[model samples]
Target: MMAPFSHTATGKKAAMALRSQLAQGAKFLLGLWMAGVIVAMFVIIPQYEGLGDAGRIIIMHVPTAWVTSLAFVVSGVFSALYLFRRRVSDDASAVAAAEVGFLFCILATATGAIFAQIVWGVFWNWDPRETSILVLLLIYAAYFALRSAIDDDNRKRRLGAVYNLFAAVTMPFLLFVAPRLADSSLHPNCAFIQGSQCDGITLELSGARIGLLGDSKLELKSLERQGDLVVADVNVTRPGYQVENHRPSFDLASGKPADRPEFDGEQFMLAVEQVDLATGTARLNIEAPGSGLLGNSRTLLTFFASMIGFTALFVWLYRLRAQLLMGEEWLAQRERTYGFPS
Candidate 1:
């Protein structure tokens, strides 16, 4: 036999207390997240290939993307649980995750648009990735619309769970499969894609490159000697990162800094306090024009902090959403004692 309504309502209050206590950790995590965001934006290295400083936007953009994916997955899992158990609490959790996921999707879209404007010279180009994101946004909108249109709570929950499941089913296809199927896309080629040309580098935790002011941070891999001029094939890694290298005519025997040739092209002047050829590096007393806020060796710290901090933020947001859902269910149950309908 089903439990009495009064008894069930009391149980809901107990569950809410437990959830509220657990959610306190999420609040702490959110605090850490905001602080980390500030540091990522102002005190970290700009991660651009060519667009100079605007590359700092990736700190927000990439994290939002990751969080969006995570939210939807959580929603899907809870929706399945709700379907199996037919619990109001489980349904609320599914809804909470979906709503939070949608918000992150919006953040990801907005950040991507800003980054696109900086590099692609346009916003909303409807590239394969952009199209996929748009599709996901539309599906989420439809799901909410469906829920709002329904009058009965039981019907709404059942339909919403089904819709959430459908959305989850489409997610991997829209986010991953469809983008790859497209023959042409403005999106840069992945370095890890076997048998594909690598026009860009991967942003991963394991790999790193370091450099000082006005230094050859990385070699032009296709560089070749053409009798007189050393042909330097600089990869146009969009919004290029790190120091810009000029094709210098001088070589190792050209007396190093004393015989350094003039860079006729563009330059980011970091005041040369000293250039040590013996160590094959230079020390700058001034800042690199487009470098991010740390402006010194501290820029290295931004790299690890941003990745870890953003990930923590995503976890906190998902937890907070789950807690909010539990609170919502508890309030509804409490009101039912006064003949309030769910």
Candidate 2:
């Protein structure tokens, strides 16, 4: 026979006290970390002059991506634990992580689109990286929808674990390996987007080049025969444009040399070499892009701190769940052995 709610006051109080302790511990740490994030936003970031407008997006985008990745990983682990221990809390944690992962993934995709607009000139470029991430979002959405469709707890946990494991395996392949198979329309083929290559010079754009200053001169052959340095003569059919090899060329509008007003290493300067946009041909150069506050060290530290704090909170919750399960099992055994009133 089921007892009245009032009959369980003692048990209820103990549960409430345990919950209060967990909540207090989590809330205090979470509140402190959130305060840090706010301070980083208003105080720390604005102090950097170079970040300007794009700096704000980093506060949003990077954390979201990190959390999204972390959440999915945690969900997969919890899903596997559910299959082993048959614990209800493990299933709950899996569900909670999945939900949070979905939310963070949404933020990641949206903020990434915003960043791409500012950096790459287009909001949605259908780049391979972007496409892979979108597919991951859809795949998790389907995972959640499947969970909702099931009513039985055991069956739900089993099926969800299977899917989560499959996703965990496939995600690495999609995010890490799949993008390398083809030429990227967006950012240059770097190590993160492309597979590793040997030490021999790896030029990304074979037919396209960009110079910091001056008009790009187009294709020509090397005049020097088998030597350390080769001189390539570029003919300028276009009027009013000067074409000189190795030496700095002048711009008609501005009297200053057309090359960058900074340091001139052979490799660095060579990257921004002769291009003929008219003929749609040129060679590639490997040079670092301009710097901004978004890439600063201090900003990255604060971002990482917030993410670590968030992960710690989840870790604490996981521990709390284990304690609660132990308490529940102990109480069940006591009731059975003592023949306590049900």
Candidate 3:
């Protein structure tokens, strides 16, 4: 009987050791994969059409934003499980995921600020997207603060889970719906997708076709060919401001917007999409800085790779943190029950 028990114990130890080794090996591979992603972001990806080298940061920024959302979703799910099952492990997982989400949210904000400074000439404009992300950060910050303030473990977990669920409910609205609903947003969505907020308007040189681009009004005055470029004279008018004629040109050779003029009193520029010199007609659109990013295949692929790497990193971090929290909880419970050091 003693010999059989010894053999069983040895088998259990071997299995645990193998699992530990496999986890370490996976972590090592993840590190290498992320390193390759970083290299590809700079070396393999081409410069974006409007954003240039600065656009490479999207590989980091967008992925972090995605991971932030994903982490929050995981936290919400675990929180719900904890509520239903009343399990300490579920509570630990929820808290771990929320902490990870908060960290990634900060990363997203930092990367976004860097991109904004290069493209929009300001690091901290109160754009809709920026404001929404700020609100999200604050919401999660409050969740952690709530956890720290509570004295009892059971009450803390219960209240924290409830608060986390509410916070998760706000995430989608803050991240996606709100920004798109704001007309004054400088985010560029029309470049890649049709029927977005800033879709270009067609105008004939008759000056009769006036359209709104954000808060500014635009009308085409003239269309003419200048060498290899098709130039359009557009009248831009903002509320409480006089009309101004701005010449936005498109390069016929490259089939791209060339001389884009900034909208009156706004950072967004006017881009000429199409021009018909004979009919004196043109398509004019408002373009925020860094528009048409990810149009390149290499850049798009690298961005996706970065997203996958960040997601895997999040999973690893979440599991490690959850285990640590579980151990801490176990020790605390032991001390409480025994009235002595765990």
What are the TM-scores, per candidate, against the unseen true structure? Answer: 0.62, 0.57, 0.87
lDDT of each: 0.61, 0.57, 0.86
Candidate 3 whole-model C-alpha lDDT, 0 to 1? 0.86
CA lDDT, candidate 1, residue 168:
86
Put down candidate 3 lDDT per residue, 1-342, tens digits, no spaces. Answer: 699999999999999999999999999999999999999988999887667898888889888988999999999999999999999999999999999999999999999899888888899999999999999999999999999999998899999999999999999889778887877777665534342555578887666577876677887777778899988888888778898889999898988888988866667888898777777778888877767777778888887888889999999999999999989988888998999985
Rank order (by TM-score, best first): 3, 1, 2
lDDT per residue, candidate 2, 42-149, as tens digits? 677554332246645656665676777777788889888988998877777776777777777788789878767765657897878688888998898888888779
Clashes in each model (backbone N, CA, C under 3 Å)? 9, 3, 0
Which model, 1 or 3, shows the larger TM-score? 3
Candidate 3 or 2, higher lDDT: 3
lDDT comparison, 1 vs 3, better candidate: 3
| Predicted structure with the largest TM-score when compared to the true one | 3
Task: State each model's C-alpha RMSD to the native.
Answer: 11.2, 11.8, 3.3
